[model samples]
Target: MSHPHLHQPRCLAGIVIYRPEFEALRGLVVSLSGDVATVAIYANSPISGEQQQALRKAASPAKLVILRPGLNRGLGAAYNALHQLAQADGNAFLLLLDQDSAPRPGMAGALMATYRRLAERGERPAAIGPQPVDLAGEKMQLPAAARQNGEKPLRASFVISSGSLIHLDAMAAIGGFRTDYFIDAIDIEWCLRAGAAGYSIWVDPTVPMPHRLGQGVIRLPLGLLLTDQPPRRLYTYVRNQLAMLRLQHVPVRHKAKFLLSLPVRLAVHLVHHRFSADCTVALVNGLRDGVLVRLGPPDRALIPFWRQGWRSRATTPRNTAAVPAALRQS
Candidate 1:
């Protein structure tokens, strides 16, 4: 893939960090040194003064800005904050990254090139993203449109947040990310809304970024591999997916696909977690809240259950908060 021409608009890269592995975080910052004008490290978790200094040093020649919320504000909130920062700084594009992703050298440039090419052809591309290749060599299934041949950017319904280069102007027109839905499915919700608003989403398959989805891959019969996630993740995933189904902007086919697969997904999660009490409760409550349209951070009622079941096994607490008063009363 070719590098974006120097004449292209400036790009700002925003990386959302939780409790990250320092080495990986440093590597990611170093990799983007010459590619982006500035690197914004948004700390969803608190960062020590020493760690902040270390992060700044990793950004090297590129300007570095730290957005320390000092608490877990969810992925959508972080992205929204990054978008505001980019707009204030007069950047034309915002590149989103998660700490788990390690983009290849020219990945950002390749995405930029695709965005520019699309723009020149009178296409309004809201965002352009690279294909996410699993680090463990698991084959992630792609949409039918994305499987087409050649280097041309393929139209996609949605792309993952990590490794996506978003056009700031388009984002302003589409509105900010949905902080209500919080973390899971934020990217899908935004991308679907963009399409509904007449902006296109593209994926440049030529640019592959090493990304990990969930905890790991669970090998199944007939070569199928399901992403293995914790029970809390399962709860958010189900709730958010169901929330999207209620949105007018989300395509009907997408909703139908999810509905069809919901049972199998729940069964898989149950078996994978050995039908543990916490896992069962998470799935049931997620379904109930989703149907009731109770959306926001994880439900507060479920937090202690998870804490007792698996909190000690995790590095960071699964951030939880009470639902809105209105929703709770309902």
Candidate 2:
């Protein structure tokens, strides 16, 4: 299964960094340098000059460009910026990577080969991604419809943002990632939109990338595995899923499934957090803002309350409704 274009530098790799582990980021950059034309590091968190120099050194031979926005602009914004960079640089494809993902050396090549095969058969593929394997060596499960039948790429409903190789033209036609989504569900929303736009999403099951979803997995009875996400992440997870349900382009079946599981998900979070007041407030406010279509950054008033070690007796407003209408509007 040799791809003649395996070493071709037609792709631009974009890695989004947010308080990432230094060695992990450096390793990722090194792994991708030889395969892609250029490696672009989008710093969602501030990076010191010393770290920048070290990263540039790690990305040797391949050009490295660091995009420092000087603020946390969310995953979608970073991807959108990377997409623009890909277009401007005239690269054929864009490879999106999160800081935590550890892609195998030839992952990008495998994805591109699959994309080519699909195109040869007249299938319009918007993007192709590698199958993700968690640290425990367990492969992420795909829906039955998405399973690979033969040599063809798996027809996934959506693939995670990390390890995904997106065709520049297809991305242009579908429009870039949604900045409003901020951090969560950015990939799912984009894939759904791509499907609606008559383009297919594929997964190269033969290619596996090491990726972790949240803090870790919480194994409960009956073999249920819930990702252990922080309260802030929990807020966006609930909020974005609810927001997606309102979009017409999002599939009806997906929305139905989410609605059925929403309550259970909330219950699990409550128990996981040990009924912490911060978790309760985040969940409640997520629901309220999601229903009200307050789609932007997280509500300002709730920020301090959800952070680590904030006293519950501090008496902060629990929901956006409690914030002044003027402040909420802001």
Candidate 3:
């Protein structure tokens, strides 16, 4: 394996998130620093002031940014901001990550190097993700990892943003993440779009990155459900999937299957996990919102949207901590 910028030295932009644990942030910083040529992070605050400051200290190279409430922008927005920041700072590549996920030693370098190789060969790889390993450094069972050996191109629409190396040029071609969709499926949406536009999304299985499975599995009679994600997550998942489906305007057959299948999947969860009122409410709201929003799938909703216009904007984040005033948008 060759180091693309062994001498060139390009800045690597990392998005170190501010989740609950201080030690987790510290570990991620250490992991990223080991492999990246140069790292600058846009730290998000979902923790206390004391914890945020401690995280800043741990992520020495990172400059913590205040995340505003009412906005609680999704990962896509954070990633897009990091890309813009990196561009301003003269970075060659963007390394997107969550606090729970950290690149293995040498993975970052290999990713960057691979991108350079593809560029040199005139093969435009939109994004490259390393095979994810669990916190214990074991490869988490992916739905289809058994078939992939070493670095391989993903034929379908599965790409992990947590450890992916994105090309600045390719990103410029297609505008950044769709902020409207909120959380789930944003990365897949981008990767799928890139693939449709003749760019390849690759996964270097050998370049291992450790990521904690944030969404825990719900063991149930029917089937295991990913119950760790919150009700709000459920809301975003519904809205985003609908938004993505609308935006892509995929084939009717595919759309029908998805529409039909999603409810069944949710029903399975509803029965198995003993669905909370919030979950059921989300299911109803999601269905209603998805059906009523006839603005065509092509309509990209604004990044910072309020469910009930200006009145609902004041609600606090249920799971995360309050954000600093500076980062908040008025």
Candidate 4:
């Protein structure tokens, strides 16, 4: 494996696949092939043999390995699997991406440059995440504090798993992603653990990755906010946030703030037209489950509500190109 940047050859890119369209997967593989030494695909669900072949063929000039866990192990397990693989393969860093996110051209180089600069400044970062821009090119109207200020890399509470460049040693030191978390808040939990151990997480402003945050985002006077998720996902979000409350590594003030905001968030769900009666039920159930520390798959009864809009944005064929021409130029 050879690349222009020093870290390109040493970094391994990993994507967790769950019902992603073949074209989208291929586009992502192809984009990663441009600079990544290896692209490890963790297939959490079954894909046809023909589709697997197409993925391999599309990842030309870059090594691709498909790791089929045989069942859906969820995001945290998939990420942990990739982290261990990267560590064993002697890669210095592992770049994690969700199936929906597409890396901007030259993102790896930009991230590595920031990593090196941070190290030079004596700030040892456990993970470095790029600012995520919505795929639709919506001006990220997040609150100034959430968006942060300054042109330089900024310290973050935690970065989303997608487009995060994590040091293998740092991952090992903090222990890997909590597999029990299943999906939501896994990144923040890992980051909090790292922070507790004196490691930091930073976000590079120069490198922006195209990501679709939720089912959709709505721009409001407050900021750009994610629309209410369908029932099951809402359950996970609530459950995971509550679970974080039980973690010793999580900062107390952060917990206090999140606790206070719970009512406002629930009130939005109650009033929002997007959320259904099922969402309210899931919310109540999730609160109970979170209090009891019961974690795993959601209640079987709620499965019916998981039907639409989970990954609708990413699964569309029209958006398959992981690195669009405009993104490359930017």
Clashes of 4: 0
lDDT of 4 by residue, 1-330 (tens): 555534444778899888887787788887777666778888777767788778777766657777777666667777877877777777888999988888866676678778888989998799998888887764343222255777788888788889999988777777777665577888878888888999989888767778877777544456636554677777888877887787787899879978998887887876774567677778876676666666766653154435422332211111011211121100
For candidate 2, lDDT tens digit of each residue in 132-186? 8888877876554344555557888898899999999998788878776677888
Residues 89-168, model 3: lDDT tens digits: 67677888776776655667788877777678788888887877766676654434546655554333446788888888
Give per-residue lDDT, candidate 4, residue 135: 74
- Evaluate residue 126 in candidate 3 and report its C-alpha lDDT on the 0 to 100 scale: 82
By summed lDDT, the worst window of 10 consecutive residues in model 2 runs over 321-330
Off by over 4 Å in 4: 5-9, 139-147, 273-275, 300-330
lDDT of each: 0.78, 0.78, 0.60, 0.73
Clashes of 1: 0
Off by over 4 Å in 1: 1-7, 137-139, 301-330
- Candidate 1 lDDT over residue span 176-269, tens digit each: 8877677788898889899999999988877888899889888888876777887777888887898677788888899999999899889988
lDDT of the structure predicted as candidate 3: 0.60
| TM match of model 1 to true structure | 0.87
Off by over 4 Å in 3: 1-9, 46-71, 136-146, 150-156, 219-228, 249-257, 294-330
